[model samples]
Target: MMFEENPPSSYLTRAAHSEDSQETITAISHVLRDQEDTQLVPADDSESFAAPGDLPANPTSPQQRLAKLKLLMTQQKAEYESKIARLEQRNRELQWEIRDTQWQLGQQRQRHRLAEMKIRNAERAKEDAERRNEMLQKEMEEFFETFGEINGWK
Candidate 1:
């Protein structure tokens, strides 16, 4: 009957100052006050929370409200822990991928070095063959001139 006569704001004001009024208020109000004191309010809602001493829309008893809050806290904790685990697993996978990429790059560098060495060796072999051919041609020309002079075939 007193609650019906007095407004919710007046009850909040009385509860703020009086210990007797705090007992009359719901436990949820006390919990909210405790959270505010410790700066640990749940971050589920972006909008402003209901003011302290505000009644639930359905008017549940203090015990029921407290139990509901406990259950909600448990669920949120589990969800956050699961998210952290998934993120850790993804981080490990990324590290493995980086290692594999580095290994492939090393292999490519070794192959490139071997290919350059082969090209240089082939170029050197070609030069040696050309020099040998030139020497043989000179020898054949000298033999022909000597034979022509001895046979009197100016």
Candidate 2:
């Protein structure tokens, strides 16, 4: 038998006889009788009507079984192919994400290196400014010593 996602509507279990109202049954029967191809099989009459020898031979002979099996295999193959396609798409998405993450990480590393260089340059400039200030202070002191006597109490 072929695998099915859902039972056919006709094969589904109906409400119990106690749950079915007479009006519902009458309405259903009327609708069914109106249909040209609808045959409401009597629940117990068919067994009594046909003798053992009168019944048809096994409908699912080897050839029919083989055909059904082939159909089932085809359906299974289609389902597998669909699943594989979806999984392949997912894998491609994951690979893209990985590459994006790597690119972002590389950008961050570049930014970090640039920041460190900026910090080093600023520190070197600060040290140079400090040395210039010290030299200027010594010059000012020497000028004061040499010119204080000329300008005032010599």
Candidate 3:
């Protein structure tokens, strides 16, 4: 944190600053990096990072490592944020779909109820028509019998 507040000028750039001042900045930043790592890796276990060929023999500056770590953390954060956004979008879409389905289901139930009511009404009409037809048939039979007796026919 202190290093960021007063970052050490690069070795290539010098403006009225003594060599001792540059060395002091480098040492302070390095100490800060070590302290930050102490919470994770042991202080004596620097070799656990990488192979000798891959790792620098001596890290004169801590800026490179800090920058790399920052970049990695930034990428991981972006990935998580993107994933969360997609999940939220999907959830909203699913909610809308569920609502639409429920509305359709309600409509279907209403239609079914209306159809059943119509069927019941048609059944009642059919029964009434059948009763009328039976009455007309009985009246016709009695009329024929009376006519036959009046005409002296069987």
Candidate 4:
């Protein structure tokens, strides 16, 4: 039956000559043209759109071929999106790891500085103690010398 002869009660009709119908038909034609223009070409035997000689001998109708191309395109898109997401997630993790490493390095450097300061302080303390010990030794020697001279004169 002609599409208009048994027009489904639910179908809405507009004058064919109306501007709206013309616009609608134009839009539909554009879509169809786009679909036709984007015909897939197979590059290798593994591709879904490969010709029969380039692919397995399994028979496939034109409808099946189109369906296969569409499915392949969808699968490729999903795979690409998934890979991008994973890479982004990995980048975030690496960035966090780098920040943590930098923080630890800073802490280690501070500890090293504190250790160096302690060593310097210890060296100074040792030098002061040595000087005091030498002074005490010289005073003791002078005292003994004086005592010996007095005894000898007596």
Q: Which candidate is the best by TM-score?
A: 3
Name the better of 1 and 2 by TM-score: 2
Candidates 2 and 4 compared by TM-score, better number = 4
Candidate 4 lDDT over residue span 1-154, tens digit each: 0111221111112333333443434443443343245432333333234333453444543443544454455456556777999999999999999999999999999999999999999999999999999999999899899998989999
- The number of clashing residue pairs in each candidate reads 0, 0, 0, 0
Candidate 1 Cα errors over 4 Å, as ranges: 1-58, 61-70
The number of clashing residue pairs in model 4 is 0
lDDT of 3 by residue, 41-153 (tens): 21232323332334345542254454444444545665677799999999999999999999999999999999999999999999999999999999999998888888895
lDDT of 2 by residue, 1-111 (tens): 122232222211243232343333443344333221322222221212222333345533232233344435545665677799899999999999999999999999999
Model 3 / residue 119 / CA error / Å: 1.0
Question: Which residue ranges in model 2 land beyond 4 Å of their true spot?
Answer: 1-66, 152-154
Measured on C-alpha atoms, candidate 2 has an lDDT of 0.53
- Ranked candidates, highest TM-score first: 3, 4, 2, 1
lDDT of each: 0.56, 0.53, 0.57, 0.56
Between prediction 1 and prediction 2, the one with superior lDDT is 1
Worst 10 residues of 4 by lDDT: 1-10
Error of 3 at 8 (Å): 8.8
Error of 1 at 16 (Å): 30
> Which run of 10 residues does model 3 get worst, by summed lDDT?
1-10
